[model samples]
Target: MVCAVIINAENKRIKLCNEIIGLMYGYIQWNSYDTEAGGIILGRENLGNDNLIFEFITKPMKKDIRTKNRFLRKDSEHIEFYKQLYSKHNGVYAYYGEWHTHPEDIPHYSIIDLTNWRKISKEDPKEMQYHIIVGRKQLRIWEMRKKCFMPKLVCEVKWDEINI
Candidate 1:
């Protein structure tokens, strides 16, 4: 289990649980032919403090489209998983954002990522959404608000930092 706390510009802490980190690390694109993998992020809000705790994430399903450089989630399983968690937790566990792997040492969001994030932000009921990109050597996290047009880089955690 490897956990990390990311402090945003506003001094708010976004905590990533060990299980969530481990699951994403398992899908990192390590080999040349490895394709992208992705799923939805789910977590609970720290009421009163406004901090976020990311404790769960869905795994890529069989219905997802995958290529060496692209990943398209076409699986309804992801949504089904979310619904189950939401119900099990009585709405405490909510959608945080999306996560995907990038075959690079340090990943940057592509144009498609930006556009998709924007659309999700506009449509999601949550006021804030957080996304993550798992790279070969790092994990980059971004935060997007419903009223914001672009997602802002919140934090980057190197593999070494997690000591995984």
Candidate 2:
């Protein structure tokens, strides 16, 4: 586990003790929800940047467009709610990535997942990134810097505890 403070790369593997790391890790731990669909968002302030903690994340509770419609539109309610969150946070925060549940056991991706990731990969490719796939036993994350999405093998992650 790399123990340091780097916000741009959201995929920091650390012992589950720190609150920020633990929160992200903990949020990914729950696979009990019938997340017919969901998404992950990531945000963080540059480390050592005063008290202004530039950290945030957003996930839209989605419809069952059949096992996580990653390309689906965001409902207005989610949009508005996020707007409020952003207003309160005062802009240091960013919408980094998303989390969702699938009907698999080992937390893998589907063809659709690859498609969605491709779009994200096209955007910046170096900024902070986020992703979550809740399978039967674990949740996986896809946080590779500047790598285009690979539908067949999108990300390497596992149950809150990342597979770095």
Candidate 3:
């Protein structure tokens, strides 16, 4: 059964996101919640088939407040930063959702994770958002549907495809 949102990304983008997430794990371990990185997932959406092709990603703003294993908070400044980036790109990119890292070798979503995704879905009922949790060696994806998050498959990736 499908348990996470299907993510279709280029190999380089996936590699980059994974690398950044891995760095977060190291930072959390070395410095304790002082650093975390995340940003919008940019891609094409085939609404008719419920498929998404994520082509690019953004970096989280420096102002975000991250915890040991959670993206605890994001201030308005960070939101504005994303908005500006999206706007400047001439609508090519959108607020697809979020991606963050965890410290565990196999991390699972927490209550806070569900709550945040639910909140975003509720606030933006018309659009479907996604959330990705990158663990040391595991990647989990969730799609917001009808005010909730659902797991889906990682359908495809680019060159030298690495099936997570």
Candidate 4:
């Protein structure tokens, strides 16, 4: 099966594993990006919703972040519709960040994801500066250098168990 992966360019390993794991464990669905433009998107099926908990990003999300419908790229309306869908669902069943997919509830990101996140993290890797993963069991953070990547263990979270 063909699958996509976002990675950290420096270490070429998975980035933001914890968030990914949480998303997967909860259910199957898409989420949103913490950008200024404000839009929600949908990914492959079997996903329900995701919640992100990050503090800051050095580079805040652009007010004009781009959007594309995986199935209806030709029609911009579809994109707009989903964004509204996300917005309407927000605060209840919706989200506020980018949407991604994984092969299973494995909870890992690809090299591309890491690379992208590294750039985002560079702007701000401060506490609460989290990136969401669409699939997997647990969140995995990768520390990399010079565009090479490797897996770094991060704190594991339980979606089912409520924290005190």
Candidate 5:
């Protein structure tokens, strides 16, 4: 299968891994959809291609709801916070995409997932955007280009454990 590695410049991979694992374990142990978490991915593309260098997992809004297999939430607060952080970092960090978790071992995007992704990407058309769906055993990557969503052939580097 073709892939494009979602390169992490520093400790980003580790940090994201830790977060995903923690979320998974928490959900499995607690038996609740409330444990499901998601956040924004921020980074730059200095090495020719884009890479997700940083991540910020945001808390769901008070009015949001979630399910065992889905994270039905909103990102307004997350977007506001990310905007502030991006400016503080002098544009070095911007919204690249999003990340959310699933309860299965092999993750797959639902139709709703794809639709939401398209909406997010369309809101900002200056550049390409990416999204990640973290499953228990694997994480799937997708990219939005020209208003279309496609599975990204993420070239896995050193993140064999996460199956990048």
Candidate 6:
């Protein structure tokens, strides 16, 4: 399993499991025809610490909107999956944030991405959320606090580093 850890400037850490990372890697925009794909991030917080361990993520469903440059998660299955995990795990598992693909060598959050993330931060029950953008060669993660106006860049993981 591809185990990876990312620590932000604020000393907050996030662990990405192999399965979820692998699934995300599959949706990287590799070709011209490739479109964006995205889903929600679900995981648990480490007790007595600010660290997080991401264990699950929903995959793109038929109801989702996909385009070469945009991805809108319109599927109800993602929420259903999150509900199931939260229920099965008895609240240990929770929503972390959103993830999507960007057809670039190095990804940066677009205006739309920022707007949507801010909306999520305000609406999601969790006080902290993490958003990930998978690029052609790397993945960038951002951390957003519900009370904060802007999300901070947590860390960036390169595709080569994962060796997938």
Top candidate when judged by TM-score against the true structure: 1
TM-score of 6: 0.92
Residue 22 in model 6: lDDT: 90
Runs in model 3 lying further than 4 Å from the true structure: 1-36, 46-51, 148-164
Sort every candidate by TM-score, greatest first. Answer: 1, 6, 5, 3, 2, 4
Candidate 1, residues 1-164, lDDT tens digits: the string is 56655656465778888888889999999999999999999988787887788888999999999999999999999999999989988889888899999999999999999999999999998788889999999999998988888888988988888757
Instruction: Report lDDT (CA) for all predictions.
Output: 0.89, 0.48, 0.54, 0.34, 0.57, 0.87
lDDT of 2 by residue, 1-164 (tens): 51223222224431122333334443342345443545445354446542223244334444324333233535565456567777886854555555565555677666766666667767854543456565555545565444634432334434434432
Q: Is candidate 3 or candidate 4 better by lDDT?
A: 3
Give, for candidate 2, the lowest lDDT window spanning 10 residues: 2-11
The parts of candidate 4 lying over 4 Å away from their true place are 1-101, 125-128, 134-151, 158-164
- Cα lDDT tens digits for candidate 3, 38-83: 5656555444554455545555556676656556545566466557
* Tens-place lDDT digits, model 5, residues 24-61: 33333133444555666765444544334544555555
Estimated TM-score for each candidate = 0.94, 0.58, 0.62, 0.31, 0.67, 0.92
Candidate 2 local lDDT, residue 103: 53
- The lDDT, on a scale of 0 to 1, for candidate 5 is 0.57
- Ordered from best to worst lDDT, the candidate numbers read 1, 6, 5, 3, 2, 4
Estimate, for each residue in 80-108, the C-alpha lDDT of model 6 and write its tens digit. 98888888888898888999999998999
User: Model 5, stretches more than 4 Å misplaced?
Assistant: 1-35, 47-52, 59-61, 153-164
